[model samples]
Target: MARVKQKGGLIGCGFFAHNHLHAWQEIEGAEIVALCDRDEKRLKEAGEKFGIANLYTDAAKMLASEKLDFVDIATTVATHRPLVELAAKAGVAVICQKPFAETLSDAQAMVDACKTADVPLMVHENFRWQSPIRAVRAVLDAGTLGDIFWGRVSFRSAYDVFSGQPYLATEERFIIQDLGIHILDIARFLFGDVAQLSATTRRVNPAIRGEDVATILLDHETGATSICDCSYATQQPEELFPQTLVEIDGSKGTLRLGANYQMIVHADGQTQTLDVSPKLHAWARRPWHNIQESVFNIERHWTDCLNSGHEPETSGADNLKTMALVFAAYESAAADQKAIDVRRMA
Candidate 1:
């Protein structure tokens, strides 16, 4: 097969856009051709920093005029559907940021639009791509743990996410929607589809309207049970471990992902810690460098999928299950810890 030189167009120039731009530039067989944002200042800044000459304040205008192979939608959750629909209609493949849409209906529409257009759509759910978590997944798949029965994927910290993205604090969905969605998706990725979910939510922080903390119980289709918990209230040394750690207990052994990218596997009376961090790139900056790396990993996967004609690990169709899990968590929490079947929402 000939190597496909895929051109990229980025939508929504925000804090996350710089990371995407840097990653796209570093990846082979991909080039960012243009950037679009409703804010002219942000658009211009990103365009100037990334050396992208073509810029647009309107996505539709950019989609119509630009000759691009794929579009990266880094905008907020509310804007994802329309932009993805536009990109799909324009015959352009799409890589969208997480929480694919505010509602399952909108998410389904986005997926259906891409299918109708015969274009590929991938959700940028990067948690599963994180190196330490990926290593944990590898260990489980290798059967070192053997027939895992229970697990926990937790994220809790006082990171002040509201200061950077204040909209998160005021949203009706709260931390579960913002942070729990990623953790839920990670559980779905590591385990199989969730059969049922029961959850409890709390607004520990007085300032937020939605629950800042949630604990969810997941019944996997494989008879493995898991807990997915998330919070913006808990304080940690670095705030990194609050959510990314994974603990799994299998019939043969146990596995744990600790803070600072440590993966410990214990089986057959033997224990080992895996050195998981790969070399960091020059542009990868602080606070959440691991997260930045994961974003790059997902971007590279997207580029490879476009080049090799394969579906990405985080394909639109696959992400529907993840999104359904998110909604199921909310429904479970709202109903006072009632077990909610995931398929009911579908």
Candidate 2:
């Protein structure tokens, strides 16, 4: 028997919500039937652009009226807890943007809400879903990398992101909350959860309210060490704006993922290089295609899991570990590079 399309409503039609909407359009078994936002102008624009007529300026009204199977919350951190709880109370699944909450407590509340309601919740943590990153994970899982001991996940670029999301520059917590969260999650995906970690942060860009650069050292529970770093102040001739370069050293050999989605794996006395760049979807643009494709992939995974009675890879409960790392990085940075146990989020 063919299943009916799962009706989904999207909340917050801001900057990155367009990517979610575009990706949702490509996902099978899912249809965004409604839109919600406080900004009337943005709501009208997105409704017309996406051809979604069921729109609301208030989420409560939309939740009360729309019979949605899921709601994708693309709003900012400040609105995350309430929106997630609202969806949970309405008995709809939720997919929320990263930096899931401003604090660990708020993140916990949102996760708890979905658990209590017996609904699925996925954090929009899409970095690990990026194809190139998945390729590296495949090699590691195949034992081709052989007992990984050390690794580095880095994303450094000077792209003018503030032009689109101007509020990032004014946030008390910037890079770690904004960009480093992805890098840290990737480290967890490639390696494992952290036992302890320390970090150092810098505000190289005078214009931003928070630190624009950060370097973190993580001790994975699998007896591996990894470095996760991010910067918006880096300047290079070849600006790899959106690419995350990776290097991992294992008992057998080393693996390197460089610019242009090139991967070199040297193992078993042999070396091989492969191009792992993501395919550009019809609606996706370059540099962002990798990210956009991951959005589609994860969303499809969400619907599949929702149907199969399986939990998503980045489920709210699972993302709690990733969320802990984000908070630990900040605590370490503020404590003058003191090592912090990942278990103690405070």
Go through the candidates in order and give each one's C-alpha lDDT. Answer: 0.87, 0.93
Candidate 2: regions farther than 4 A off = none
Best by TM-score: 2
TM-score of each predicted structure versus truth: 0.97, 0.98
Q: Deviation in angstroms for 44 in model 1?
A: 0.6
**Which residue pairs clash in candidate 2?**
none
What C-alpha lDDT, on a 0 to 100 scale, does residue 15 get in candidate 1?
Answer: 83
Candidate 2 displacement at residue 149 in angstroms? 0.4
Candidate 1, residue 46: how far the Cα is off, in Å: 0.5
Error of 1 at 191 (Å): 1.2
Q: What lDDT tens digits, residue by residue, belong to model 1 across residues 1-346?
A: 7665799899999987888999888887889999999999999999999898999999899988989999999999989988998999899999999889888889899999999999999999998988778888889889999898999999878877787788887888888777888899899889888889999999888998888889999999999999998888887656673338789999999998877667888999999988787447789866567888888899998888887889999898888888888888888777888889887775
lDDT, candidate 2, 185-302, per-residue tens: 9999999888999999999999889999999999999999999999999998998989999999999999999999999999989999999999899999877898899888888888
